[model samples]
Target: MGRVEPSLFSSTSDPGIDQANRPDPRAFWVVTFAFVLTVTSFGKYEISRLTPLFFYPVTIGTLYGVSARALLRKAFFALPFVLLVGLFNPLLDRQVLLEIGGYSLSGGWVSFFSITMRSMLAVTSAILLAMTTPFDRLCLGLEKMRVPRVLVTQLQFLHRYMFLLRGEALRMVRAHDLRAQGNKPRIALSTAGSMIGLLLLRALDRATRVHRAMLVRGFDGEVRVLHPLRFSWSRDGGFALGWILYFVLVRLVNLPEWLFGWVVGR
Candidate 1:
């Protein structure tokens, strides 16, 4: 008998890191397509008819080896808010839509589940974008698209601060944990509120000092990129357009449903 190779042994490169390191104009198109697809997921012509086309991004993303775990984690972590907001759907709309596996499903439940699916797909698409494109490149891509310079600079600062803020918050949490009595692990709401206030104060203080330092260092308000966006439209324009066309097609046609029907010979 021939020896079979393990699936893990077939791995080659990490696509997420590779994509982020490579400066490609095509990434903008990919992000645009993903966003368009996500938006279309919410456009339900009928309450019961949920779109499965959104999953196409996941399929493509996996092929390109995006960080599936991080994407899935973020999506799932954000799902409770979607569920909580949509909770009233089942209560408010009681009209029965269809029967599935001996159980009746109402329109509200159908829509609720559909919304959940949409959120998951949308969030996954965004995570894939972040994983595949460096934050600086994304801001540059925005600039290439003729976005305002001030807005792009603000975005860059905001992106930089997201990491700083998270790091600061973690340090604060660690300090809190060190002082806290492990025997009684629960933190009261009032205590949490005070902690939050303190965190904000520290964050503001740090921001002011950083701003003053930047001013002292002869820093202007312009955001400069080491490797600016370089695009050869003749080479990459058609490639972007092709993806855009596919996006439009997907929005117009429910490819999954059509394929299923074709496969079943309906």
Candidate 2:
């Protein structure tokens, strides 16, 4: 019998490592500013003001080749949680706080709407960051920010193994297909059970192999990355200053309401 070929799915790895090289400190600063502003905006319940914050990351991601659709899909996963909390707003807080000609609205309704909007903004910003920043560099950034080395190492391992697990799973599926040639597959509990068992077995084997490879390469459960992170003065300074200005303008200054009024007028 012909040797079972490596699964075609195994060949399809994550996109190229073009994003792995450390981003310019300027780029990192832009992302950091966007992240802090976005998170802080969400925390303060500044719904309308947060809309402008999306532009930074979206612009960066667009330039950096991150998929908009994929980022939005990640945002979609949070919808249920947002809705669950938001639904209570209209029901619990029934007192009318504002009157616009004839429409009456409650504080709860306003708060809820603000929460939902900010939630979407926050989640989208996070997704954009993850998409544009390679996971390893992100961990390095965290390490630089004083995140514990243990946590960073765990994150690095998880990201690397996730891709490996995906490849292994694909190989198992292809092997099953090859073995089941000309047989009508039964869609039943028994078949499902067998498939799960086979998948687990193959996954364990792959993990063992990966662990051995790591040990051979002198991995003592600590990842030693080659490029040590270096902060650039001009780029990082400019980036930080931009974020400081943004925070001052958006939070400290009264810009959001004015911007909202202008948009509505237009």
Model 1 lDDT at residue 13: 23
Which segments of model 2 are wrong by more than 4 Å?
Answer: 1-45, 98-103, 171-201, 260-266
Regions of model 1 farther than 4 Å from truth: 1-16, 19-30, 45-55, 183-186, 232-239
Local distance difference test scores for all models? 0.62, 0.64
Query: What is the Å distance of residue 30 in model 2 from its true position?
Result: 8.6
At residue 206, candidate 2 shows an lDDT of: 78
The candidate that achieves the highest TM-score relative to the unseen native structure: 1
Clashes of each: 0, 0
Tens-place lDDT digits, model 1, residues 1-266: 00111111111123325443343634554546556564555553233233545445666566555455655665687888878867888898889887989999888887787777666666666655555566666667778777798998897777656555665788888777778887656666888899888888887777778778888988799766576666656545654565566666666676777888899995
Q: lDDT, candidate 1, residue 38?
A: 41
Worst ten in a row by lDDT for model 1: 1-10
Model 1 residue 169 distance off true place after TM-score fit, in angstroms = 1.5
